[model samples]
Target: MSYLSRSRSVYGPTTSTTCLNKDDEDDDDGGGKTDNNNNNNADDHPGASMKQRTRIGTWNVLTLAQQGKLIQLANEARRMKLEILGLSEVRWLNFGEHRIPSGQILQYSGLRGENAPRHRGVGFLLSAQAHSALMKTRVRNLTIIQTYAPKFSLSYDAADLQDKENFYSQLNATVDRIPKGDIMICMGDFNAKIGSDNSNYERFMGRHDLGEMSENGELFAEFCGNNDMVIGGSLFPHRRVYKVTWVSRNSFTEYKIDHICISRKWKRCLLDVRNKRSADIASDHHLIIGEIRLRVARIPRQEERVGRQFNTRRLDDTTVKRSFTVELQTCAADIPEGGSVEDQWTAIKNAFNVTSENNLEERRGAKGAIQRSKTRGAIYSARQRYSALEKKVKRSCRRDKRAWADSLADEGEKVAATGDIRLLYHISRRLSGAKINATMPVKDAIGQLLTDPTDQLKRWFEHFEQFFQVPARPPSPRYDPPRVSEPIRVVAGVRQGCILSPLLFLIVIVEILVGAIDREPNRGLL
Candidate 1:
C-alpha cells in the first residue's frame, strides 16, 4: 500500500476526504483519493504500514479570553480529526495546563505576573489520543519548550525588533532542548511572506509559496534554514483560498502569514499541509492542518476515575432534609461502638456515603448537559453565513457582500453579548484559539523545577506538612490548678487552602502549649 492509502486506513475520511491528490498533478479542488497502485514498491520503505497517521494543525486565534472558547476549539479538532492543535495569540494570563470537560488537555505559556495583561500567549490543545501519546511537556517563556512560538506582528519599531530577537532566542533554546529522534514542529503566525521564490532557500522552503518576501520572511527562512526545518505550508500545492492563512479585515486582501514547519530529517512524515478554509473559527486566520505518518509505540492508558457526588441542592427542600435527617439517625443508631477512633470515623463516613447514595441523586451529567446546549447550532449557523458572505466578497469584490459580512460579524458579536451564555461561549471559543488553565511549574526544596504531576503533588504535600508543623519549645509555669480527670484526645489533618484548617491547627497548638505551660516550673515567663 502507498503511504497515503495506509494513512487513510488509519485516520479515515476525517483527513483523507479533503486531501489533495499526491499523484494527480493537475488536481486543484484539493480533493482526490490516493491511488494505492501508483506506488507499488511500498515495501521499499520498511515499517511504513505499521505507522499511525496523525493530523496536527496551527491557527492564530486572535485572543482566547471569552468563556466556552476551549470547548469550541475541541469541537473543531474533532471535526478535523486532529491529534494536536497548535495555537497562537491565545492571550491568556500566565502559564498553565487546563483539562477541558471534553477530556482534551490544553497546555499554555504566556507572560508571567499577577498584574500582567493578557497578551502574546501560545499553547497546544491535545486530543485525548494525543494526550495519551504525549511523553512530556516543557513550559518556557513562549515555547512549551516541549511542544511550540507565538505570532509576531508586522511592525518594525525598536520594541518589535527587541521582541523578535527575544522570540528567536527563546525559540532556538526550545529547539535545542528537544531530544534527538523526537518529532519537532514549530508553527505560528510570523507575519512574514516568503513569496514563491525558493532560490537560495530551496532546502527550507518551496516555490508553491504565496505573496512577496518581507524582511520578517528572511528572518523566518534563516531560522528554518539554521534549524533544518521544512516549511510545510510552502511545500504543498493548493488553491488560492486553501493557500492563504489570513484575510484582511475589509476582505480586500489576504496573506499566508501562518505556517507549520517540521524538522527536515522527518519531512517525509509530513504527508500534506493546507489551509482548511471552511473551518468556522471566527478568526481571520484559516486553520492550517498537516498530516504526519509516524511509527509510534503505544503508551499505557491512564486509569479512569469514577466517583459519585450527591445532589446537595436537594437538601434545600424541607421534606428531603427531614427524610435525610431521619435516615441518618436510623443509620447512626445501629453502629456498633467497639472500634478504634479511625475505625469509628471510617464507619461514620461510610454511613454518610451509603445514605447519600440511597437518598440523594447523583450530580453526574448536570454540568455536561448544560454545556451541550442548543445554542451551538445557532452560533454555527451564524458562522456559516459569515463564511459564505466572506467567500462571495472575495470572489466578486462585491460591496454588498462585504457590507453583509461586516453586518453579520457585528450581529454575531451582539447576539453573543446579549443572548444565551452557551451561544456566547461557543462564539468566544470559535474566536479564541484554545482554552488552558494556568499550570505554573512547582519547584522542590533545592529549587529544581518539578515537571512531573506526581512530583508537583508531592511538593505541595511537603509544603503543607512543614507549614502546619508547630515548633516544640520549653514551657512557662502555669498559675491555675489542674481540674480535668482525663486528657482529651484529638486527631487533625490539615487540608491546604481550607479556611477551617488553619483555625483547627492553631487551636490544637494552643491546647498543647497551654497544657505544657501549666506543668512548667517557670510560669512567670508566660
Candidate 2:
C-alpha cells in the first residue's frame, strides 16, 4: 500500500503524512527525507557501513492514555524503523515495564498516587531490536519532569523558583547516577530557547541553534557543560522548519524548544537530528528523530517469574487499609519467634506477601475506565470541531483564516482544561515537540568494532577485565613493622543524607590524596 493510503487508513481522514496545502510545503525546510531509502541513507554514514545503525526518536505524544494511541505510536515507529522512541507526557499511571502485543517493550514512569491525574509522565518504547540490547533503566523524579517556567512577560515567583531548583536538583542526581562509561542521551522538552549564539558555551552548544537564549536556556547550557553533553539539534544543519519544533496558533511565530542531546564523548555516534514534519499524528508537534550507529548485546533470559505489583492505591480506602493491617497482623502472628535471623526474616517476608495477596488489589488490567471514557468522548468531539475549523481556515480568506485559527487555538486550550487528554496533548505537541536520541557502538580492546551481539558482550567482558587488571605487587619490605597490641576499631560509614556526610567524604578523599602524594617516589622530581 502507498504510504499516504496506509496513513489515512490507520489515522483516519483528519490526519495525513503530507502537508495540508502547498503553502505548508513552502514552510518546510526540506531537511527531512520523505523516502524510506533516503532516511536509511541519512542515518548511516559512508564510514559507518560496518556498524549497526539504530534510529532513536523522541516525541511528545501528548498522552499515551488516549485510545489506540500507544498502538498507533508503535506502528509509526515500525514504519519509520525507529529502534528506540522516548515519549514525553505519556500520562501512564505508576512505574513499570510492559510488553505490547507487537513485541515492543514500553518502560514508563509517572506519578505514584491512584488519585493523581495522569500528567507529566515520561517513557521509552523500545522495538524488539532495541529491547534486546537494553541493559538497565533508571527512573528519577525529574528525569521526565515538566513544569511551567516564567515566560518573558511574567515575573519569577517563589513557587516557580522552587520548581526550577527542584528540577535542577533531580536532574543532577539523575545524571550523577549514569555510569560514566555508558553512552548517555538526555533529551526532552526543556522549554528553553537556546539561541544561535555559541559564545562562551561553545563546548556544549553549536551555532545552528535557533532563536535567542532565555534564562532557562542558560541553566540548560550549564547542565550540558557540567555533564559533558552536546546539543544534537544545534550541531546539525537543517531548514528553519526542520529546526523549529513549535509554531504559534496564529502561524506567525515559531520556536525551537524541543531538543535532543548526547554526551560529548559520543557525539560522533549521532548521524543526524531533525524534525519530521510530514508525520501525521493527532499531536501538533512534529517528530524529532536521531540516527546513531551502535552495537548492543541481548539480555540473557531467566527462568524466574516476575512478582505481581501490589496495588498500593487500595490503601487510600479506610476499610481496605484496616483490613490490610488486621490481615498482616494475623499472618505475622503465625510465624514462630524462635528462629535464626535469616529464617525469621524469610518468615516475616512470607507473612507480608500473604497478607498483600489477600488484602491488596491486583493491577492486572486497564484502570480508570470511567474517567477514560469521559475523556475520550470529550477529546473526540473536540477533534471533530477542530477539524472543521482547520477545513474552514484552509478555504477562507487570510483575515478570516487568522480569526478561525485563533478560535481553534482557544478551543484547544478549553478542551485540554476539560481533561480531554488527547486534545491537550495535541495542543502541547503543536506548540512544543520535545524529543531526544543517543547511542554508542561497542568496540574491542584493539578498537575493532563488534557487530555481533555475542561479540559485543565478549568484547565488553575483555575490555573490563583488562581495565580492572591489577599489576603484580612488589616484594614485601624486608623489615616488617611490629603489629600493635591495642585493638583497632573502624567506624561505620556516614549516612548518605547526613549534614556532615559530604564534608566527611571530602576530608577522607583529601587525606587519601595527600597520603598518596607523600608516598610518591617521583615527589623529589616535582
User: lDDT of each prediction vs. the true structure?
Assistant: 0.61, 0.60
Candidate 2 residue lDDT tens string, 20-68: 0001111122233322333243244332121444566778777787445
TM-score of candidate 2 on Cα atoms, chains taken together? 0.47
Off by over 4 Å in 2: 1-50, 133-153, 296-386, 389-526
Find the 10 residues in a row with the least total lDDT in model 2. Answer: 1-10
List candidate 1 segments past 4 Å from native. 1-50, 132-159, 295-439, 442-456, 462-526
Error of model 2, residue 254, in angstroms = 1.5
TM-score against truth, every candidate: 0.53, 0.47
- Give the Cα error of residue 520 in candidate 1, in Å: 31
Model 2: per-residue Cα lDDT at residue 25: 14
TM-score of 1: 0.53
